[model samples]
Target: MPAMTVNDAPVMFDMDPETPLLWALRDAANLTGTKYGCGVGDCGACMVLIDGEALRSCLVTIAEAEGRTITTIEGLSRDRSHPVQQALVAEQAIQCGFCTPGIVMAAASLLRRNPDPSEADIREAIPNLCRCGVYPRLIAAVQRAGRVTRRRETISAAPAPGIDPADAARAVPAMGPASGGEADGGTTEPED
Candidate 1:
C-alpha cells in the first residue's frame, strides 16, 4: 500500500499486497537470508522477526507486514559471530546448514524473549525440521549460546568486524627462514 522500511531502508511494494513476505523480501528487498522452505509455513526456514516476533515469512503476506519492522537472519548481527552462531559452532551443531538458520533464528527469538530458556522452551521454540540429525547439538547450542562469556583478555582490542580472506592471510605471523616443511610448501627430504 505504502512505502515500507526494512533494515533501515525504505522500499515500495509495487506488486500485489497478497504477495508472500518471503518473495517480497528476497526478490524486492534482496534479503535472501530468510529462505524459502515449505510454502505452507510448516518448515520454519522462512522465519523472520516482525516487530520482534518470529514469523514464517512464507506465510506472512505483504499486506500483513506492511510498514512493519521485519528483521531477517542477516539482520541479526553485523557478523555471523553472534552468540547463537558461536555456540552452534562450539557445539558442532550444524550439518549442511540448511535447517540451522531457521532453528538458530527461532532459538535467537526464544533467547530474546526468555534469556534463560529451559530444554522444553528451546525445543518448543524451534520446531523447524533438521534432516542432518544435529538436533541434540542444536538444542544444547541454544542453551550454551544464551549464557555466553566474552573473554576480554583473549579478545584483541582491534577486533575485525568481519574477516576478509586477503586480510587473514596478511595477519599470519611470518615464519623464520627455517627448514622447508609441509606448511612451508616444500618436502622435508634433505637436499641432494
Candidate 2:
C-alpha cells in the first residue's frame, strides 16, 4: 500500500491500500485526535483537512492520500494560542472539551480558507459531534476567532512584542474583544 503523510510528519502504512486515513493516523502514526465516530463519515470527529478541503479521515484511504498534504488538529497550531483555540477559551465554550480539538481544527481550516466566513458557513464547516451542546457559544467564538486572525494578517505581518507583565495582568479577555471575540492566550493551538 502507499504511504501517507500527516501534519508534515511522514509515515509508511504496511497494510492494504484501502486502509482508512483515520486508522493509519491512529494505529500507524499514533495521532488520535481524528476520533472514530460513526466510521461511515457523517460525524466530524475524524475530520482532517486534505490538500485544503475538510475530508473525513475514516473514508480517505492511505493510497488515495499518498503524498498529499494533510493537517490534523495537532498541526493546527504549534501551541495552544492558536486563534480558534483562543476564541473557544474567550467564549468559554468548552465543557467536556473532547470535541474542542476537532472543532478548533475544522474551524481553523475554515477561517484560513475564508477569513470572513458567515455564521452559516462556520456551522456547515464544523459538523463534529459535541455532546456538550455548546453550539451557540461555539458559533460565536469561531466567528470571533476568525475575525481576530484575519485582522492580524491584514493589519501587519510583522510580529508584535510580548505583552508586559502589567498588561498581562490586565489581559483579561473580557476587558476587551480579542482579534475578534476570542481571548489572547499565551499558547496557541494544541500539539498533535
Top model by TM-score, which number? 1
Model 2 residue-pair collision total:
11
Q: Model 1, range 74-135, lDDT digits (tens) per residue?
A: 78775766677778877889888777667777877888888677889987888888778898
Q: Among all windows of ten consecutive residues in candidate 2, which has the lowest summed lDDT?
A: 152-161
- Deviation from native of the Cα of residue 83 in model 2, angstroms: 0.7
Q: How good is model 2 by TM-score?
A: 0.74
Tens digits of lDDT, candidate 2, 24-90: 8888877887788788977678888888788888988898998888888777765566778777877
